[model samples]
Target: MSLKYIDLFAGAGGLSEGFIRAGFEPIAHVEMNGDACDTLKTRTAFHYLNEKNQIEEYYNYLKGKITRNELWAKIPDNLINAVINTEISAETLPTIFEKIDSVLGKDKVDLVIGGPPCQAYSVAGRARDPKGMTEDPRNHLYKYYVEFLKRYKPKMFVFENVPGILSANNGGYLELIFEAVKEAGYELDKKVLNAKHFDVLQDRKRVIIIGWKKNLKLKYPHFEENEPQYEILKDLFSDLPKIKNGQGEWGAVDYAKETNNYLEKSGIRNGVCFTSQHIARPNNPNDLEIYKIAVNKWVQDNKRLNYAELPERLIKHNNTKSFTNRFQVVNHKGISHTVVAHICADGHYYIHPDIKQNRSITVREAARIQSFPDDYFFEKSRTTAFKQIGNAVPVLMAEGIANKIKEMIK
Candidate 1:
């Protein structure tokens, strides 16, 4: 039988997707955003029907041929009901537990995976906040995670967060986390992991904490570095049709060129001829001009554009002293910088390396950089899609972790 697990604070199912690919069955996904919840359900439907060779039904939905309601009707009730949409808080814990209990129904939870939202623990977020996010209530959300571990008594768990988490609260919160987990009867180990090491194209990093039952004989899995088959611009982006600002659509877009060996080996250009969310965000005249300069600077000198060095006419912000190097072009020649949640607010930091396009990266490009497959759709508004993509753990990286986990558990 496949091992069962629960995902907490599941963002667009990135981590869960990895676990699922590694052969674990997801019993439940607990999240607060209703839109992300919809995405989780859609993906669940895809997995269930795809196993039954009904992927055409999903392709139909993505092609705009069928409504979401129609797609859900074909999926089983149990799979559709696994996603629980609500906040995990003190007031809501009881109800969440009751719902999980109903769904669990004698199934032993072999694992619990997920991390609380990282805003309070993010360095960028703290820099923008007045109190440095020390006063943010999210600092204590780990308490709720501990509550789940105690309740389920999973043999193992994976907790993920940003590097800032190690220093947040001067290490007070992490101390609390260790204490809480120990009190709940689990031994834990932690390390900083990079997605590039896991065959992901982006150089994203996260703090991964692994825990197991106190008496269990388990060790933190050793991960090895993996190299991708092609460059970011040449292989990852060449197949997608290019468009200018405010161009492209969420529906299907035909492949711009024939798939190469690198693309196939990377599992990026999967047999699908079309994908969704290739659309770019609309850009204002000033932003467009700046984007042109940013892309040109990269194409010529391979240097980042400084906000303070922009033409006088294109200048907008009064205080250029801070965030001077905000307009950064993605390093198309190699691994790109971290894909952060802030991209949803503005794409200035994520200017596409292609000068002809003359805009920020598209939703599909961002998703691809994060190692999400082309067919994995992010539901709801485009901005929200960006947010979900930005916040998610890279599926490629998570799969590597999951594979090791499967081996260890077995």
Candidate 2:
């Protein structure tokens, strides 16, 4: 039997997707964003359809070969039953818990996995609103997570967050988090892991807190010495079709005829591809020149050009030393810096490696680096899509953790 799990604060279902890939059945996904909720439903519907051996029907819909109604007609009933679009809080917690109980009575949930909004504990968020972060109600959102753990009493639970949590509120938040997990009767183990170590193409670090009943005596999974090597942007993205600045491609974009190991493992099979969401934003002339210089310096000159090194024509400010490395050039052959939610604001920190592109990385390329499979679609506007991708846990990194959890449980 597949282990059952529920995802809370499930933005675009990244963690849930990885867990599901590791053989866990998703009971439900709880998220507050309307676009993300729609994505959840669509993805869940696709999964249910796939489970019923009807993925071809869904794929046909994605390729525009069938009507939306026709696609839904093939989706299993369980699809609609699995996504809950609501905010979890003290006020709505009881009703939500009651419904979960009703739907899953006597069926024990094996795990509960989620990361509450991390803005209150994220470095960028703290930098942006030094005082507002501490005062933000989101700081205590984990209490709702704790409440679920207390009520569900799942065999195990996974709490993920930005590394800023380690020092948020002078580390008091971390202490309280551990205390809450302990009070709920679970032994907890935590470590800060870099996604690069798990074959994710970005140098993203996240703190994962795994908790389980004391009686189970489960040990956290150790990093495998033989795990896949760190991936570079070129390895993950070179197969994707290129889009120029301000270019957007709907429907299907063609993939290279040749398949690489990463592409194959990521579910991008060798065939005519129907990838979506590969939209690139138009860079202003000023930013475009900056991107060109950055990419040229990184690729041709073998250096990262700082603001001070730029020609006076491209220099916009007097204080060049402060934000020297503001325009980051991604080395195609090297792993990327962390992809963050701020990417939605401006792509200055994530310029595409190819100088000819003259723009920041596209939504699809960002998703690729984050280990989201080509088939996994991000619904809504470019802003929402980028935010969802940037904020997501690298799916493969989550998968590695999920696999270890499954092994211990089994």
Candidate 3:
């Protein structure tokens, strides 16, 4: 029988993609974002649930209250364009659970994998509330995940999140996760894995909490201590055409020829810094001065730029003006700094090793570094696309975990 799995909080199907590549058959995915749901529908056979209204029995309850035409009207036109569209309302959690139960029945599911939104516990957040102690009510979503695990009783699960959870309230939140899993009748082992140790060219470190139902006797796989012999940014992106920052799309090139020409005229050959309204320099005097001069000059001169012309949806950098100051150049020959969600908006630190342009990383380029295949289509809005890519478990990293799961199941 084929290994079966379900992905919850599946954003852009990154975890799904990893599982698929590792030979698991993905049956269903639950994602709240419409654009991400569209991306999932386009790529896989899995059902995309978008229903946002409460209906006791989705099939029977939604009957005459809204006609087919009326129900269609309720969905956004952009959402209608998605391949496997359905409405999934937050209030309809009980209905969703029923539907999922009906779908799985008594059949065995090999795995249940996901990383719920951890922004509430993220170190990047401004409040710095210790881990596990989230002021945001949304932090309780973990309880829902545990409930799902108990109901499904999958052979294994992989819960991922930021490293802050370890030290958050001095490991209180991490302990809560352990207790919850234990209560659910699973043996859990937690480890912080660096993406660089795998084949990922970026140096991102994330916590992977692996839990196995106690009845299944399985040992955690030991990660190799030796780094891969050959890993570099150029290796990841060599085939694509070299356009200055913000120039190329997958098979579609948005060449800013005039901008390139202007840069050539100005003796600035590296690349044009893609300007963004959302990006502000840190409060530091020197950083502020540099950013102000750069922004003023770029705006005043009408400098040709690659991604600068894109709408606000394509870019959202940290509000701090000194973000650039904190940026440390990655040794091009070595692994890059951790690819974070914010990297999508601010490419200040992710500059090309060979190019001089200071533009943010392109969505495709970032995806490539994250080990997504070239054919994998990302949604149009740049920021959302980047968030999906940055927040994903590296495909290779997921593959490693999946392979281990495969061994235990056999």
Candidate 4:
């Protein structure tokens, strides 16, 4: 029998994509974000909640709103046949249970997989509040995940998040999650996975918590070590038409030349670079004029300077704790760093090497690095697009996990 799954907190359907590839049919998905829900609807044939406010009328309402054009235009035809959207929350587990009961009625879902928002435990966020408190309210949501597991009791589940959750407060949160899983009558195994090992060029590390009903005697699968080398920026994006900063085939644009130059000088090439404001000049302007001048002056003053000779002035300027510090470049040669939501605001870590500008990485390029196929349409607007990409699990990584899950299920 084909396995069936229900995805909670499904962001851009990364987890669902993996499950689908692994041969599990996605019956229902619950997400709060409208754009993400739209993307999900476009990609799969699963029943979805309507855009309406009322819960009972959601499915009917969506039937009218989801036309072939709207759905097909946003998602590839291959992935559109298996999605259902439910606008619900983990807090409303009873309602979700009722919906599932109506559809599947006595049939147990084979798998449940989700990654709740990690902002509370993210390493990139401020570690402490003004009172020097370390606790973030968002940290408590993991309990909700456990509650859902208790209510639905899927045969298996996967919980994903950043590595910081493992060592946060010296493993307190990790311990809490483990205890909750134990209490839920599931045998749990946790591992930190690097995306590069699973065909992602970027070096993103995430923690995956896998659990199955206590009666299963299956062992946790090991992540295979694969060859590190793969296609680089030149290989992946060489064929696409070049769009200068603030320009793209799908209404995407390029950054200023100055921004591009900065990234190029820093050894960044290919992929998108983000900028805070798109000040329309005759050309893309590098906003860091003063910093660039200072670096040049320092370099000129020391004629004997080598790569090591570049003064700390440039380093300080680059590392300054300001909005400009957000200027980042995503290197095309290796795996990308984690795609974060704030990446669009500044390119601190995501600059492009080819361009001589200080622009942030674009949503499309970010999605590409995350192993999203080129044809996966994103809702318009850079911010929304970036959020979708950032929140998505790397599709390739998900495929690898799916393969493992399939083996275990069989």
**Model 2 TM-score (2 dp):** 0.93
On a 0 to 1 TM-score scale, where does candidate 3 land against the true structure?
0.70
Model 3 lDDT-worst window of ten: 272-281
Winner by TM-score = 1
Off by over 4 Å in 1: 227-229
List candidate 2 segments past 4 Å from native.
65-78, 225-233, 268-272, 316-321
Question: Which ranges in model 4 have alpha carbons more than 4 Å from their true place?
Answer: 45-91, 126-135, 251-284, 288-325, 356-359
Summarize candidate 4's per-residue lDDT along 151-176 as a digit string, tens digits. 77877888898887876667888899
Instruction: Return the TM-score for each candidate structure.
Output: 0.97, 0.93, 0.70, 0.74
Expressed as tens digits, the lDDT of each residue in 1-410 for candidate 1 is 99999999998999999898889999999999998999999898889878999899999999999999999999878777789999999999999888888888988999999999999998888889999899999999999999999999999999999999999888888999999999999999999999988878888889999999988978898988666546778878988898988998898788889887766765667898888889998999999899889888888888888899998999999989998988899988987899998899999999888888988899999998888888888899889999999999998888899999999888
Ranking by lDDT, best first? 1, 2, 4, 3
Clashes of each: 0, 0, 16, 64
Tens digits of lDDT, candidate 2, 1-410: 89998899999888888999899998778888888887787787678777888777767766778865666566555456567778998888987887677667678899999999899998778888958488989999888999988888899999999999998999889899889888989999889988877787778889999999989988787876334454555467766677788896755566644668877766544243567777788888988988888888888888987889888988887887787988997768778889988888888988988776678888888888888877777776788888988888888888989999998888
lDDT of 2 at 393: 87
How would the candidate models be sorted by TM-score, starting from the highest? 1, 2, 4, 3
